[model samples]
Target: MKEISTLRLAKELERSERTIFTVKELTSQIKDLLENRFLLVWVEGEISQLKNHDSGHIFFSLKDEEALLKVIMFRERARELPFPLREGLQVLCFGRISVYPPRGEYRLIVQRIEPRGLGSLQLAFEALKRELAARGYFDEARKKSLPAYPERVAVVTSISGAALHDFLRVARERWQAEILIYPVRVQGEGAAEDIARAIDNLNRMKDLDLIVITRGGGSLEDLWAFNERIVAEAVFRSRIPVVSAVGHEVDYTICDFVADLRAPTPTAAAQQIFPDRKQLIEDLDFRRRRLFELISERLRKLERELHHLSKRLKSPEKLIQETGERVQDLEARLRKALAHQFFLKENRFRNLVRHLEAVSPLAVLSRGYSVTRKLPEKIVIRKAREVRTGEFVEILLEEGRLEARVERIHPDNHLF
Candidate 1:
């Protein structure tokens, strides 16, 4: 019965009219369908599992809460991105869907990409900020300090703009400095290069104390020149201190972070770099008064000390008389000390003389004792055997020395 059932199922399968397809054939059809259907479509989703390949291609998953799609950007398209693509970043991609035949999977072939909420300019700004920070371009240690009193300032801005006028007015009100207006476009094409060149030129000048890169407040698009990497690099490389006054207080740019100082506005920049002449004069006057007070107090203190010293001081004549009395006392004491020292020296001399006389050989010779020494050698004979027979000898008597011949050396026993 099982064989009959198998036979009947095989016959039914052969009779049925159904199309059969290989995996490759089916995948090719799907690839064509997806590529045609999704041509030039836009997709918005959060990025995930991002992979930046060494070949400059980027691969990632685009995911919404409900579904996930595989995405790919080739080297050429990826290179055009102003910012790096990262995981979890929401992005809008324009591409066509295509299927991989081997894996039987469909993915987006992205031709263009952008951050979801941020414009290209803002994306570029953030990207550059991170890069420059990593390069230490915004380090506090590298930023120069503004001079206390700037002697010469070079302003890089458009002369026709209100920013230049505002800066000049504030500068004139504050301090008298040499204002060198290096006019350059503050926005639009070629503005960043122009500003960078102006900075470099100002740095080459001999006596420029500060360089102010300023512009009137505007939208981010209108103020993009200051946000450029060229401007930031110029500000970083400048030998003279840089003041970035690009916009209103709320606006910020790359130049602001890299500059030595950031001022809210052009007018505020001038106020910051220049001293207030009126305030300085007031301060000098106050210091002069304080100095005068200090001098007067010091003189008073010295005068009081002098008066106290004068009261304790004796007259010259009285001082001389007392000095003479002291000299007389010192002279008497010196004479008494000298007499005592002489007496002690004389007693010491007498004792030394008596002791020397007791040990003198002349004293022994005068008491009938003689000293005999061999001639030529002059060796004193301590024993009778010390003298050689027939040798010449010197005999020291009480009054004089005599030369004699030694006839014999007597035995010591015979002498006893």
Candidate 2:
């Protein structure tokens, strides 16, 4: 029986006709290892053979210097990642170590991937810079808000670096610009995180009008502290417009692109931001002179108008001469009126004389007419009834008057 068992074991363990575990048992064991038996873990690795399957699963390899391990993250886990994963980049893999049931091959079911060193972070920085710059966030038009008069400027820089001293000396000399240092490490291990925190703290400062998130200029590698995605984001998102003077002007970085304004150096940033006292005074004087010149020119023009029209002012002598001329004209009109009146009076006198000659009793006397009157009656005796016999009578002759006594009277033959 033992010999039979040995022969049966050799046949069952054949490579071509190998006796394998049943599919259900194998899968059940895999589920137990992945969910219950094995510990959840994080692994360090580089990436390779990256495949984003149509079914929404990501497949890749995590490799070290000697060997490699396969990894897979479902769409559910892969999508939560902030950045894309690529081949040959080192990353810290977070997930459970497990195996596929069918092939019995081991792989990490990745829950998250945190990139190692600066490679992954640099990729993020470059990507974000491109994105924000595309949206005009880094535009010159968006830059603003120099303090009305900035006496205090808060510096978020490293105490270990030359930034604090350089900033203080130059800023003070230029404008007596004051500095309040929020000292932090500008490079190495946890530098980016500290820098971001420092920036946040300084932004809360009440006395500070403006903030300079700067450091002494350095090479691309030496300036890894500034190139960090966290630091760049902090600078970009600051409410107080940040002046980033991180590196030389020629060496443009992601921070330079995202900051409100970029200065070539720390000293240049200070000088550029602070107001110049002399220049402001000159501008004020220039405006005052312009205003005075305008007022003087207007007054001079009014004076010239008054001078040009001096001959137009009225005088008493001129008024008297004009009045005399008017009086002379009135005298000529009066003379003409008097002449007209004399002519009219002469004509009226001639008419009156002719009328008197025609109707006067003296004219009638010259025509041989007489008016007879009864003296006793004092009436004209044109008829006999007015006379009595033996009455005295008077005659009104043409040229003379006569008196008579009536001896007899005949009424029928009374004619005088």
Candidate 3:
């Protein structure tokens, strides 16, 4: 059917009376014309419907108050979008127009998409900030604390950048510290990766007390490397505290949120990390003077006490007499105490002897009580049940032991 139609159209055109085209030929021509003419165009509209395919293609409708246009974005272009596209979002789409022959439809093939009211970079920054914030990257509790006095510090930044010079000048002047500069690209391609790697390497060293990731003031694009997720993650994972001093005072980045300290500028970062030597010296001197005064006051108090004590002192002869009297009195008291203690001990010993006699079996035997034991075993028989008939038993008295044979066995419950 297609061939027949092509032939008919060709015959019609050859007659010179009219020009005709088959459906496929016409659609092809339209596709070519639209693609070539509108190679690049920008369209602004509110997204009404969006569909994402498994093939990573996006199909959506862009509609305004007056018109609606179908849009399609392929995988390569769609992946570059920093923020998600959704229905009811107003956006500016940049792409070319193309026609599909099978469906006989024309749609815009988008290469880029940006939120209508904001720049692409700004929108991207905001999107990333929200994502990382949700993951606790920007939490204050998660941020590390900077060193009070850093002996060794690392500055991860472009060696040639002005930030390094400013930081070093202020740091050197304020305090004595070991400064280690790790050179890296501050911006442009691969800058984020370089900064992250430097941070990881410095952390591995374990000698640095503080790390300062800094860059000079520049446009948003120029400062974007510091805002990357890789740099933010590196700063978050660092064992040593990190100080972020990127761009000017008004500038802020993801690194600033994730760092232990955020400095408005590179010079400020230095000031925070290093203490002023002159101030410290003055403080130490003041403390020393105060300590000296305190010691002098304590000594004067001791002298006063000594003087008071000396005034209470007596003549040597009188002191000796008084001491002799005290010794005599103590000796008298000691004699009396010894006699009293001896009397108490004598009474205690007599009482102990009485208690011992109360429990002594010999004393009981002397009182006419007898103890009996089975012969040969020598075990004291407390009950008649313990001795059987015809068993020889020994009787213990205060004077002598007598042996006898048990004639019968009997148990005395009342005696027990």
Candidate 4:
């Protein structure tokens, strides 16, 4: 009876095969049936045989211990992956079935792929954080130091948020710095970009000493702007020192790591950056009082010293007597100096006079020598021939001048 049934089924199969469809038609029909039956289905499996093509399409196989399903995510859909795809990674995929007519194979057309244990956004955040950290963006060495006293502070936050109000309230009471608000979206789409742009714009102002980036506490999705790479990079590149005050004290974000300073809250940032005016006044008063006391003490000490010195001092008459005695002693020294100088000058003068007397011609004349000169010519008779036998000559002697005639001219040829 089973063989007779099998034969009847075979004849029915042969009849259906006589009107068989082409490969394309068959694949299209199967694709349509499977896609329609499993539209927008969730599939959880481990990825295997993954291939990321140059065209940005990802082709892989999702498998389990029992079976495997071929998956293909096109470029447009694959671009939305928050994390990198790899073989043997367990994932949850949402897509519909699709067929390749040429290959006659049906594949799961994936729209989105997420890691099994973590949310997509969280995975993206971690991925971006790792990338930035590897590039030294989160290095503490790159961070700038905040000004000791910032006079102009720029607050980048949502104008409608309570953060601004809290910051302003604390700032106004604490310090006299001018607050400039750069209003931007703190949540939702484009919030990260808005924050980055605001930071860049605030940096263009040379007068801005501090940039405080802040937002109120919220869910991870709402606080994602502070975690974005755009905002982190902006904080890192800012010329002015940046202060990140986002969410509550327990919260942390990428901006907090890259910023020059990280405050727990907006109010905390205000208090940390600004000095308390009352405390400053009190400190100034304390220092001023200290300085005045020191000066007064010094003056009092000087007065005491003066009094002590005055007590040890002599009377005016005694002072005058001492001064007079000093003057008399100085006068005696002056007279002694003058007498010594006069004795030295007298010796020098006497030596000069003796030298002059030794060189004088009258000294030679005193030794019985005379100077004779021919009369009328007044030439000195140095040679006998200088005077004729009858020429009158004058003889210069030590006592007087004598006039005489040349009586004899003795020829001294033999002596020459």
Candidate 5:
């Protein structure tokens, strides 16, 4: 298709010789007409010789496994490229198909070219880097400490990553908390969109006290997925706190800046958010033991002080002198109270004994009743055969107890 257009276009330009023309004039006309003719066609190929020119225009070749085409984009379009153009990368350029008469070679005038696998990530990185840098991730002061005792935590990462398992282990072991997962892909084409969606989902869950965005360590290109603008903005604008743990400690990305905290690894991130439950239990046990010891020591001190006070108390001589003065008064009061109290005691004594016996549990056994207790198991023997062989039994009969070992028992065969 390109070949046919090229042959026809060449002859059309050559026939224009009836009009006066210089070489420069012909090149300009060719450039203008070809540029106007084909606008925004999708060309898929591999980048072969990619170079950024001094004027900022990009010159490159797009080749497949079979053939190649020359491509050029002016500085304006070149500057907006999704990723750094490089040789050996597969790409799709949106551009006008054209011919340069001076070179007489067909070319693609690239408006914007996206690297097949790397474009979205590269675009995301560029966008997020710009925004977060403005918001101060690169700022040394903005980084904050991770939660040390998060009770409710959320994880935003692929449910399949080893990082998920690693983080879960650390969180459960350390905090024994309720962990909520807002799972998503951590890297690849739509990874940024997925991450942003997960963040948004977690934001609506009010009980989530902290969010952990993490993935296992990977190379720079792999980690670039986390550096996207939507993902970064999601972290920054989260209502609940966020902890970015995208890769290894050294692997920093845009999400790290916007997050409230940044952990070195997924496991490290979980550890940072969670307080060690075992350690907390140990601390509580120590405090309880200390309290018990303090109470025991105080009781001992009080007992010792009472004994010492008792020793200092004057007893016999002082009591005798005190009693003499009270004796005359007591004799006078007794004469008056004797008539009333002595008559009441005889009647009240029998009643008091009856009341005490009524309240006692043993009173039931004295009235032609015997209490039976079960052997070894200590169940009360409400029926005769409750005890098994080799069992010892106790019989309660009022004031005395009888112990007996089980003998062969017989049962009535008749239905009752």
Candidate 6:
């Protein structure tokens, strides 16, 4: 009975050894079962231990109150997320279960993720808008003014879009200008990057006066490229003035806020940048007419003043003839006055000569009187005492003079 029992135990041991497996083989079997069973699934959890690698891969753990699951997003999937991932954020993830054979671990290979309540795209838009506002990207002072008359313009848009056609039509109607098309993708993956690169490239050219970034209306997802921070930064950094004409009037994007000017539509953007050609021509014509009117009025005023002056002016020949007649009259009057004056002067001269003769001693001498004076001194002798005895004396007449010696001196009775 003991020998039979030992042989039965040996058979049981051999069967058990045949079914046993190594650690790698057992893990591989578990991996195959989990992967096949959970090919695609939706897991809701709060993110934790989030690690974003420089290689563009994201590693994290999704945990709830009682359980936690390891998760990873490769670079290709990670870049598709519009909003940034943070710790403790409640998210819904769609992915397949994957096993790391080397570590004997299972994790979720996330294909897509979304925030629990608000849409991820909307959340991203709001978050980026706030960040850019804080950095002064939306400051009115920093915005450049669009040219009143844009001579050269560069448009960034898809060639096939209706936005380009609308803009071209409006611009052509309003003004004559050089339009440069800088074609780029308006929506889809890498659209934002493509737009930004186009903006940067257009800025390199020296001749562009303005940049117009335009696209037709679409859903939020379709219009998302304009809301990207990359595109906003490109608009902000541009030296050339930028106009954002991205959608219908109701839809607003980050690019609209950051651009120098925002238009309701592509047509409106063209209208704002270019002046009306016909109106400008009319204005120039009006100014020209006004200038001519002013010149005519000035000439007419000067002609009237010249006419008034001519009326006051005298003929030179007539003035000279009048002056000669007056001179002749003055000469005749002067001669008559001189003759009357000379006759009066001659009568006065004769009366003066008679008065001088009445008082002249020479006339008295001519009437037989003489004047005697002491000799040598020739002093007049008014009385006999003026001469001394034995002194020579002289006598004067009108025409002759005599000299004699005084024999004696005498005194008159009136002197006693």
TM-score of each: 0.64, 0.53, 0.58, 0.62, 0.47, 0.55
lDDT of 3 by residue, 165-213 (tens): 9999999999999999999999876788799999999988967798899
Off by over 4 Å in 1: 1-118, 351-416
Instruction: Write the number of the candidate with greater TM-score, choosing between 2 and 5.
Output: 2
Task: Give the Cα lDDT of each candidate.
Answer: 0.88, 0.77, 0.88, 0.87, 0.78, 0.90
- Candidate 2 on 168-224: residue-level lDDT in tens? 776766576676788777766677778788878777777777788778777655676
Cα lDDT tens digits for candidate 5, 247-281: 98888887887788788899888777887888899
Q: Which stretches of candidate 3 lie over 4 Å from their true place?
A: 1-118, 313-320, 330-416
Quick one: best TM-score, which candidate? 1
Question: What lDDT is obtained when candidate 6 is compared to the true structure?
Answer: 0.90
Across 1-416, the per-residue lDDT of candidate 6 in tens digits comes to 24668878789887845777899999999999999999999999989999999999999999999999999999998866645787777788999999999899999999987666446557767877887888999999999987788889999999999999999998999899999998899998679889999999999999789999999999777898898767987899999999999999998999999999999999999989899999899999999999999999999999999999999988999889988899999999999999999999999999999999988998899988899998798888898877778998889988889989988777865645
Q: Given candidate 5, what's the lDDT at residue 382? A: 65
What is the model-wide C-alpha lDDT for candidate 1? 0.88
Q: Write one digit per residue (lDDT tens) for candidate 1, span 46-130.
A: 8999999999999999999999999999998876554567767787888988898878788999987655654655766788789
lDDT of 4: 0.87
Clashing pairs in 5: none
Cα lDDT of candidate 3 equals 0.88
Clashing residue pairs in candidate 3 (N, C-alpha, C atoms within 3 angstroms): none
